[model samples]
Target chain A: MKIAVDAAGGDFQPENPVKGAIQAVNENAHISVCLVGPEAPVRKELEGLDYPEDRLTVHDAPEIIGMDESPAQAVKTKTRSSIVVGLGMHQKGMVNGFVSAGNTGALMAASAFILGRLDGIIRPTIATFFPTIKGQGLMIDAGANLEVKPEMLFQFGIMGKIFASDIMGIETPRVGLLNVGEEKEKGSETLKKAHQLLEALPSFVGNIEGRDILAGNADVFVCDGITGNILLKFGESIPEALQTLLFAAMKKNQIDGEQKKLVGGLLKEAFAPFDYQAVGGVPFLGVNGISMVGHGGSSPEAIKNMIVNAARMAEIDINKKIITSIA
Target chain B: MKIAVDAAGGDFQPENPVKGAIQAVNENAHISVCLVGPEAPVRKELEGLDYPEDRLTVHDAPEIIGMDESPAQAVKTKTRSSIVVGLGMHQKGMVNGFVSAGNTGALMAASAFILGRLDGIIRPTIATFFPTIKGQGLMIDAGANLEVKPEMLFQFGIMGKIFASDIMGIETPRVGLLNVGEEKEKGSETLKKAHQLLEALPSFVGNIEGRDILAGNADVFVCDGITGNILLKFGESIPEALQTLLFAAMKKNQIDGEQKKLVGGLLKEAFAPFDYQAVGGVPFLGVNGISMVGHGGSSPEAIKNMIVNAARMAEIDINKKIITSIA
Candidate 1:
C-alpha cells in the first residue's frame, strides 16, 4: 500500500514530514510513502536519512498553501499545492491514503472538493480520538460543520460507529449523543430530535453528559462541530494547566530537588494520556477516502504515528465499511 | 441583612443547612439567618449547635421539593416547599437574599416565579463561578436558558458586566462570547450574530474558546445555556477523573504509605481550585432578588460559603446595578 505525505505543509515544513515518511516506510514492511513537496528541499532533507530506496520516493509539487489563507479560496486557487496534489493522488488511486499536518480547514476543503463525500453522506466530519479511562473513544464532527441539523448528527453516529468497529476494532461500538444532561428531554431541539433517531439504533446507549466524556461511558460520542471542537481543544489544554499549577505549588512549598524530580516524573506519567503528540493525528471521517490531519506543531514522532494510523486505515479498508454501513 | 436558607434541601438535608446557617450568622456581624423547612427536624439539627440566638431562627416550611421533581410543576404546586418559601421571603422584603442546595431547576423556577425578572431582562441567567489561573471568573447562562436568541446574549453581556463590576470588584471586566473559534466569522449562526452584538459593548473582548476557561482569558464568558452547562459540568468532573487516575497509578507502582500520603497532600493542594465546595455556590443572575444555588451534595462548609456568597451579593445590591445597566 502507498500513502502520500504533504511534506511542504505544517509549521516544521519538510523536516518533520520527511523524517516521519522515512520512519514509516522503515517500520511498516507492507507500506511505502510518497513525500509530496518542492523537489530540491525534499531531496536535501532526505540526504542524511537512510531508508530502503525502493520503499521511499518523492513527488514534486512546487506551490504551497499558507496556514493563514482562507480554506476554500486557497484550495480553489492553489491547485498545485501539496495538500491539493496529495489528496488528488488519493482521488486518482495512486495512493491508498494521505496524511498532513497542514491547515485543517484547507485539508477539509480540499478533501471534500477533490475526493468528494461517500454515498448517502450529507457532509464530511472530523473524528478525533480521545483517551478515556478504559482505553480510547472517538468524537465526531470535531470542527468540520459547526452548525449541524438533527439528521447530520444521526449520520455522525452511523459514521462514528463504522470507524470504531472497523479501525478501532470495537465490535458493536456503543454510540452516544453528547449533551448537557443525560435525560432525553434535555439539550437543544436538534439534540432532542437526534436522540429519538439514535435510540432506534441497536448500539445506542442513550444521551451521555459532558462528565461522561472522560468517564468512558461510550465508544463513539457524537455532537455538532462547535461543541466537539471546543471539547477537543479544552481536553488538550488539561495537562498544561495541571503542570503549571503543580510546579507552582512545589516552588511555593520549597521542595528538595530530588523530591521535585520524582514528583515531576509521577505527574508526567499520570498525564501521558493527555498528550496530543502521543495520539498522533485525527481522521476526517465520512470523506470518500482515507485522510488524516495532524496538529500543526506535530513532532517527527507524531507525524510517523499519523502515517502508521493512515496506513492502518488503508489496510482495514475503513471507507468501504463506512460506505456499506451508511447505505 | 437577613438571608433565608433552604433547610430541607441538598443531599445532607437539614443538618448541613443548619450548621452552615449557624456558621454564617456567627461569622458575619451584620447578617441574620432564617432556616426555612419543617420546624421539627430543622430545630433538632440546630439544638446542639451554638450560635447567636437572636440572629438565627427557623421558619416553618412544611413541603420539601425532591431533586428529581419537575421544576415548573413543583414550583407551581409545592408552594410551601423550602425553595419557594425561602424565595418568597426575599419577594416579601423579609430577607435580603436566599440560598439553596436543592433541585437547581426548582430553585430557578421558584426564583423566577416569586422574585420575577429585572426590568428589560429577557431571561434570568445562572452565573457560575469558575476558578481561573488569576483568581475566579463568571460564566453566564450556565443552564438557565438552553436555547437563547442573539438579543438575549447581548443582555447577558450587560448583566455579566454589571455583576462582575459590582460584585466581583473587577473595575472594567472583559466580556467574551464563547465560540468554536476566535475569528469573527466562525461558530454557529447564533454565535456569529451574537458576535456582532457583543462587539458594540464597551467591555466586549471578542470570541473565547473552551481552553480559555482555565487560562483566565476573560472576566465574563457568555454562551447559550446548553454549551455553558456542558462546559461547567465537564470542568467540575476533571479533578475527580484525575484523582481516580492518579490513585490507580500509585497503587500500580506500589508506593509506600508515607510517600502516598505526601503525594496525596500535594495533589490535593494542587487540585484545590477545582473543588466546587471551596468556591461555595453560583448566583442566579438577572433575577429581581439575590438568589444562590449550591451543589446538591454540598457539605456544611459549602453551605456556609453559599450563605456568605448570598450575603455578599445582597450587600452589593447586584440586581439594582444590573437593572440600571440594562436600562
Candidate 2:
C-alpha cells in the first residue's frame, strides 16, 4: 500500500513530515510513502535519512496552503498546494490514502471536495480518538459539520461503529448519543430525535452523558461538530492544567528534586493517553478514500503514527465496509 | 438576616442540612436559619447541636420529593415537600433566601414557580463557579433551561456578569460567549446572534473556546444549559478518574506507603478547588429572590458554604441589581 504525506504541511514544515515518512517506510516493508511538497526542500530534508529508496519517494507540489488561510478558498484557489495535490493523488488512486499535519479545515475541505463522500453517505464526518479508562473510544463529527440533522447524526453513529470495530478492534462497539442525561427524555429536540433514529442500530446504547465519554461507557459516541469540538478541546486541557497545579503545589510544599522528578515521571506515564502526540491524529471517516489529519504541532513520531494508521485504515478497506453497512 | 434550609433534601438528608444550618447560625451571629422538613426528624437531628436556639428553628414540612421524580410534577403535587415549602418561605418574604441539596430539577422548578423571575427576565439560569488557573470563573445556564433562545443566552451573560461582579468581586468581569472558535463567524446561529447582542455590554469579550473555561480567559461565560451542564458534569468527573488512574500507576510502580500518602496529600490540596464540597453550591440567577442549590452528595461543609453564600447574595440584593441592569 502507498500513502501520500503532505511534507509542506504542519507548523514544522518539511522536516517533521520528511523524517516521519522515512521512519514509516523503514518500519513497514509492505508500505511505501510519497512525500508531497516543493521538490528541492523535500529532497534537502531527506538527504541524510537512512531508508530504502524504493519505499520512499517525493512528489513535488510548489504551492503551500498556510495554516491560517480560509479552508474552502485555499482548496479552491491553491490547486497546486500540498494538501490539494496530495488528495488529488488519492482521488486518482495514485496512493491508497493521504495524511496531513496541517490546517484541519483546509484538509477536510480538500478531502471532501476532491475525494467526495462514500457511496450512500450523506456527509463525510471527522472521527477523533478519545482516550478513556477502558482504553480509547471514538467521537464522530469532531468539527466537520457544526450544524447536523438527525439523519446525519445517525449516519455518524453507523460510520463510527464501523471504524471502532474495524480499526480500534472493539467487538460490537456500543454506539451512544452524547446527551446531557442518560434518560431517553433528556436532551434538546435534535438530540431527542437523533436518539430515536439511533435505536434502529444493533449496537446503540441509549444516551451517554459527558462523564461517560472518558469513563468508557460507550465505544462510539456521536454528536454535532459544535458540541464534539468543545468536548474534545476541553478534555485535552485537563491534563495540562492538572500538571501545572500539581507542580505548583509540590514546589510550595518544598518537595526535594528527586521526589519532584519521580512525581513528574509518574504523571507523564499516567497522562500518556491525554497527550495528543501519543494518540497521533483523527481520521476523516465516510470519505471516498482514507484521509487523516493530525495536530499542526505534531512531532515526527506523531506524523509517523498518522501515516501507519492511515495505511492500516486503507488496508482494511474501511470505506468499503461503511458503504456496505450504510446500504 | 434569615435563610431557609431544605432539611429533608440531599443524599444524607436531615443530618447534613440540620448540621449545616446549626453551623451557619453559629458562624454568623446576625444570621438565622429555618430548617424545613418533617418535624420529628428535623428536630431530632437539630437536638444537642450547640446553636442559638432563637437563631435556628425547625419549620414542619411533612412531604418529601425524591431525586428521581419528575421535577415539575413533583413541585406541583408535593406542595408540603421541603423544596416546595422552603422556596415558599422566600415567596412569602419569610426568609431572605432558600438553600437545598436536593434534586436539581426540583429545586429549579420550585424556585422558578415560587420566587418567580426578575422583571423583564424571560427565564432563570443556574450559575456555577469553575476553578481556573487565574482563580475561579463563573458559567451560566448550567442546566436550568435545556433549549434556550439567543435572547436567553444574552440574558445569561448579563446575569453572570452581575454575579461575578457582586459575589465573585471582579470589578468589571469579562463576559464571553462560550463557542467552538475564537472567530466571530464561528459557532451556531444562536451563538452568532448572541455574540452580537453581548457586544452592547461594556465588558463583553468575544468568543471563548472550552479550553478557556479552566484557563480563565474570561470572568463570566454563557452558553445553553445543554452545553454548560455537560461541561460542568464532565469537569466534576475528572478529579475522580485521575485519582483512580494515578493510584493504579503508583501501585504498579511499587511506590512505598509513605510516598503514596505524601502524594495523596499533595493531590488533595492541588485538586481542592475541583471538589464540589469546597465550592459549595451554584446559585439560581434571574430569580426574584436568592436561591442556592448544592450537590446531592453534599457534605455538611458544602451545605454550610451554601447557606453563607445565600446569605451574602441576599445581603447584596443581587436580584435587585439584575433587575436594574436589565431595565
Candidate 3:
C-alpha cells in the first residue's frame, strides 16, 4: 500500500512529518510513503535519521499554502503546493491515502477538488475522533461544509458509523444526533426532520444532549457542519481552559503548606495525561480517497499517530466502505 | 416594593420557597411578599414563619407543571399553575416582580403572554447569569427562542450589555458574539451578517471563540437560543462530569492520595457555589414587567437568591431602562 504525507503541512512541518514518515515505515514494512514538500527542509530533517530507503521517497513542491490562506485561492494558485501534489498522487492511484497538517480549508478544497466527493455525498465532511467517557466516538463534520442539508446530515451519520466500525473497532456503534434536548420534537426544523430519518436506522440512539457527549452516550455523534463545528471546538477548548484555570489557582496559593499540597495534588489528578495534539489529524471522510488533516500545532508524536490512523484507514479500505455505504 | 414568590415551584417547592420568602422578608423589612401557589401546602410550610402580618399574603393556585412537561403544552394546559399566577401578579401591578422555579418554557410563555414583549422586541428572551473567568456575565434568550435571526441576536447584545452594566455593575461590559472562531469572517451566513452589523456597534468586541468565555475575553457572550442553551448546559455538565471522573479515578487509585485531595480542592475552586435557580430565575428581559423564571431544581437558597435579584431589578426599575434604551 502507498500513503502520501504532506511534509510541508502544519506549524511544526517538515521536521515532524519527516520523523512521522520514518516511524510509519519502521512499523509497517509493507507500506511505502511519498513525502510531498520543498526538498531542502524535508532533507534537512531526514539528514541524521536512518530509515528503510526503499519504503520512503520525497516528491518536491515549490510553494506552500499558509494557515490563513483562502482554501479556494490556495488550491487554485498553489497547484505545486504539498497539499495539491499529495491529492494529485492519491487521484492517480500512486498513493492510496494522503495526510496533511496544513490549512484545513486548503486541505478540504484540494481533497474535494482532486479526489472528488463520494457518489452519494453532497459535500465531504471533516470527522473528528475523541476519547469520550464511554471511550472513543467520532464527530463527523467537525468543521468542513457550513451549510448542510438533511440529506447531508444523513450521509454524515452513515459515514461516521462506518468510520467508527472500520477504524475505532466498534462492531455496531450507536449513533446519536447531537441536539439541545433529547425530545424528538426539540431543536430546529432541520433537526426534527433529520431525527425522524435517523430514527429509522438500526443503531440510532435517538437524540443526545451536549452534556451527554462527555458521558459518551453515543459511539457516533452526528450534526450538520455548522452546529458540529461549534460542538467540536467547544469540546476541544474545555481541557485547554481547565489547564489554565488550574495553573492560575495553584499560583494564587502562597502561604499554604498542606493546603498548597492539596491544591497542587487535585490539579494533577483532574487532568488526564492525554496529548490531545498527538491525536492530531481528523479524517476527511466521504472523499473518494482517504485524507487526514492534522492540527497546525501537531507535534512529532501526533504526526506519527496520524500516520498510523491513516494506515489503519487504508488497511480497512475505509474509503471504499464509506463510498459504498454513503453512495 | 412587592415581590411575588411561587411557593409550589422548584424541585423542593413549597418548603424552599416559603423559607426563602421568609428570609427575604426578615432581611428586607420594607419588601412585601405575595406567596402564590396551593393555599394549603404553602400555608403549611409558612405556618411557623413569623413576619409582619401586613407584609405577608397568600394567593391560591392549585396546579403544578412537571419538569418533564413540554413548555408550550404546559403553558396551554396548566393555566392556574404557580408560574402563571405569579406572572399574572406581576402583570397586574400587585407585585414589583415575579419568581418561579416550576418550568422554564412555561415561565417564558406565561411571562410573554401576561406581561407582553417590550418595544421593538419581537419575542421575549430568557436572560441569565454566566460565570466568566473574570466574574459573572449575562446571556440573553438562554433558551427562550430556539431559531433566532441576526436582528434578535443584535438585540440580545444590546440588552445583555445594559444588563451586565446595570445589574452586575460592570462598566461598559465587553460584548462578544459567541462563535466557532475569532476570525471576523469565520461562521455561518447569519453570523457573518451579524458580525458586519455588530461591527457598527460602539461596544461590540468583535467575535469571541468558545475558549474565550472562560478566558474572560468578553463580559457578555451573545448567541441564539439553541447555541446559548447548548453552551449553558455544556458549562453546567462539564464541571459535574470532571468532578465525577476525578472521584472514579481516585477510587481505583488511578491517582495518588495527595493528588486526590488536590483534585478535589481544584474542583471546588473551579466551580462557584452560585444557586443559579434562585438567582431570581431567568428574567424575561424585553418584557413589559419584571418577571423571572427559576429552574424546577431550585432549592430554598436558590429561591431566596432569586427573590433578592428580583427585588434589585424592581428597585432599580430595570424594565423602564431596558424599554427606553431599546426604543
Best by TM-score: 2
* Model 1 CAPRI quality: medium
Rate residue B24 of model 3 by lDDT.
81
User: Residue by residue across A1-327, what tens digits does model 2's lDDT show?
Assistant: 999999999999899999889889998999999999999999999887799999899999999999999999999999999999999999999999999999899999999999998988889999898878788899888888888888899999999998898888898899999888999889888989999999999999999987887788898989888778888888888888898889889989999688898888888888888888767778998889999999988898999999999998999898888988888
- TM-score, candidate 2, first chain: 0.97
Candidate 3, which segments miss by more than 4 Å at Cα? A247-270, B248-262, B273-280
| lDDT by residue for model 1 (B1-327), tens | 889999999989999999889989898888899999999999999887789999999999999999999999999999999998889889999999999999999999889889998888989999888767766788888898988899899989988888788777888999998888899998888999999988889999999997887888898989888777877888888887887777777777786588778678787888888888767788888889999999988888888888887888888877777778777
User: Any idea what lDDT model 2 has?
Assistant: 0.89
TM-score of each: 0.97, 0.98, 0.95
Error of 1 at B15 (Å): 0.7
- Residue B287, model 3: Cα distance from true site in angstroms: 1.9
lDDT tens digits by residue: candidate 3, A171-261: 8899998777998988888778889888777989998887777777898988766666766666666666666665566666442677566
Model 3 CAPRI quality:
medium
Which model is ahead, 2 or 3, in terms of lDDT? 2
lDDT of 2 at A59: 97
Q: Candidate 2 on B1-327: residue-level lDDT in tens?
A: 899999999999989998888888888998999999999988888777688999998899999999899999999999999999989888999999999999999999888888888899999999998888778889898888888888999899999998898887898899989888999888889889999989899999899997888888898979888888878888887887888778878988999688999889888988988887768889999888989999999998899989998999999888888888888
Better of 1 and 2 by lDDT: 2
Please give, as one word, the docking class of candidate 2. Answer: medium
Worst 10 residues of 2 chain A by lDDT: A272-281
